[model samples]
Target: MRKILTLILMGVAVFSAGYFFDKYEKNTCRAGVAYSIGNVDQKFNVSEEQLIEVASKSESMWEKAVGRDMFHYDPKAKLAVNLIFDDRQQSAINETKSREKIAALEQSYEGSFKKHESLTDQYKEQAKLYDELLSAYNESLNSYNSLVNYWNNNGGAPDDIYNDLEQKKASLSGQFDNLEIKRNDLNSLAARVNDLGKQLANITSTHNSNVDHYNVQFSAPKRFDQGDFSQNTINIYQFSDINDLTLVMAHEMGHAFGLEHITSSASVMNALMEGQDRSNLAITADDLNAVKIKCGYK
Candidate 1:
């Protein structure tokens, strides 16, 4: 009986150890505390505390999904938007600000410059063709004139021969007229190039000014990761040009937690927000499933 009881106890101990190890291996991203990277821009509407608050809200989504804490607030964190406001812009734009005006102006100037560049090669080819046609027309005119003089000087020349020269002159004159009209069209296109150049310069100046304004309006967190898990930090930048500040914050936190952008518009991890279905600012079912697959549940 003693021998049988000893074996049973040993088997239970071994089973318990195996279960602990398996659970430990599966649990991920629970090691270190994350710190908030403080605000740099004083004028930013969202305070550092508020940034933390939003991040906490984002964390709740992931935590609920994984049944584990993915992030925590530490005073120290790394820093890591706006639209004419470039998509690259990180600071959030005020909702009251005119996104339409900025977007339209940016579109007009950027589109104009791109169109101008495309036309350069086309215009060069057209101008070269015009020159070639002009040369051919001049040659034909000179040749016709010489033939007419010859007929005038030599009145005995056949009437049929004179008729042929006149016909040739008329044909060349018609071609020259058509070529001149095409050349005038090209000239009009050339004038637009100069006008677009000025507009491009003006747009460039305006874009720089808007960028500078955003720089002053918001601040981003600093990022620091040096191989050590404890040292890994994601300082969330509080200011953004997008109205969905919480969504952006969640996206950044996702990066810190080794999550990637998803193609589904339903996910907060989408690469683009434009035309995306951002009905929920939290991690979707798919997103949670992916995280669980990667990080496992508690």
Candidate 2:
């Protein structure tokens, strides 16, 4: 009976050890990290659902690269992914707004320049036509005056000559009328050109002012870590857009997975955001190798 009891005790100990080891592996090793969306600041203008979707997408990158799951979403998970509103994010937001304003101002300035160019061209053409018309009017008037002077000096003119003078006077009057119309048109164009010039000046002033403001406020090179993992929580402080947010989240998730920063600039585990490809975020080979090493894979 004692021998049978010893064998049973050894079997119980073996089973218990195996059970706890399996649990440990699942919780801290092969099963990956579990995370959940926590505080999403309203200032971000994003919903928790949107964050979850992006987080899921980010997780899928690692999972797909390794052909296994690297993250799990659990409502009760200890890891809380938070979008915390702070000065970092506010600065980024302000920079974005300023850039947008500057872009709009630039567009307005370009449009005004094009309009000014076109109007200037029109003004030149009209001015040229007016000058030509004026020259023709002056030459015709001189000829008419010469003819009248000859008739007056001679004391009497033939009926045919008088009729010709009358016809010349009518033709000169018609030319004068045309010159008046052309002069008015040219004046109108000049006025329009002047108005546009003023408009362009105003736009330029505004654009320059905006540029100055941007330079004053946002020109400094800011290099802060956008997110961090600590105390079992991930705090996201700043991101330029949704893609940036995803890449930041992925970077933090790499930390949560017990991976360290890699030297490769293109790796998701890189220390700096400058080299990360936010648009086409994926786990590089370096990241995959790091994860494999961390999880005890060969």
Candidate 3:
């Protein structure tokens, strides 16, 4: 009787385990994990101001990374990878690859061999995790290649479609026990995100009247401003963003030209410039000449 009961329970456990794995395999990336640039194309309507800022920012970063050398209808440049907003951050600040962790990872890279002349269950667990990570890393590579191919064909696909790419990066990242592979993958994404950030920074810097020129970068909404440095550079924060910075572009240009912040919300140079007007993507002359003043009066 005892033996029969033991067999029944074992069977039940196996069935339950199989059912769970079936569910997991069917849904690889989970909900909200694989946002494609396809959806961003259909949605994401932006005002003119936002458009200029985004275009300028994206272009600037793309230019700086590989440079604008291959802009005239090049398929490869067009298909280059873009950073997802969620993946754009400073997470690496706390990132660590400790010595102990490194040694363990190195061991994982060698692949498991028998210890005590037997393959124990411990080996099985490590092997499973290693294989899972390897699969995920390959998937990311495939995804990047496909996107590049599409761009090279001039497919007009929007980039940054996967709104949750950052989150996905974290989860898929766990599959690799090899620290070097993990580090390289994480660094690649980090470098791309940093490149986007540099472009955004240019937008803010472009408005400084005090400096020869400034760089601006914009990716999100955050309350920030330049308290001083009005003597050397101008930093304008407009509920600052990537999508709608054209007006802020004008306002910053005004500061760059020697104009003080304006009270007239009606004026483009007004410190209180709103998004609607800014989205028009226009910069006024008063703002222009101030920059020209540094260049010499006509």
lDDT of each candidate versus the true structure: 0.63, 0.88, 0.39
List all candidate RMSDs to the true structure: 14.0, 6.9, 42.3
Error of 3 at 22 (Å): 76
Report the lDDT tens digits of candidate 3 across residue range 1-298: 9999999999999999999866643332121011111112112233434443443543332224322221112223212212212212222111122323444544543332323113334444555665676776898867755765676588644546443454555655564446456556555655555554554454334423212211122212222131111433323222233433444433443343234654444454545434235444443444334333433435
Kindly list the per-residue Cα lDDT of model 2 for residues 1-298, writing each as its tens digit: 9999999999999999999966865565667899988999999998999999989988998889888878999999989999999989988988999999889988988998899999999999889988988998899999999989998999967999999899999999999998898889889889999999999899889889989998998776444378999958999999989998999898898888777888888888888777777778888999999977767677
Q: Could you arrange the candidates by TM-score from highest to lowest?
A: 2, 1, 3
Q: Over the stretch 60-151, how does candidate 1's per-residue lDDT look in tens digits?
A: 86777777777777665442211012222322345225444557668988898898897766788889999898898888889888888887
**Deviating ranges (above 4 Å) for candidate 3:** 1-229, 236-240, 262-264, 285-298
| TM-score for each predicted model, relative to the true structure | 0.44, 0.82, 0.22
Q: Residue pairs in steric clash, candidate 2?
A: none
By TM-score, the better pick of 2 and 3 is 2
What's model 2's lDDT at 37? 86
The deviation in Å at residue 94 for candidate 2 is: 1.0
Candidate 1 residue spans exceeding 4 A from truth: 1-107, 216-298
* Global Cα lDDT for candidate 2: 0.88
Error of 3 at 16 (Å): 86
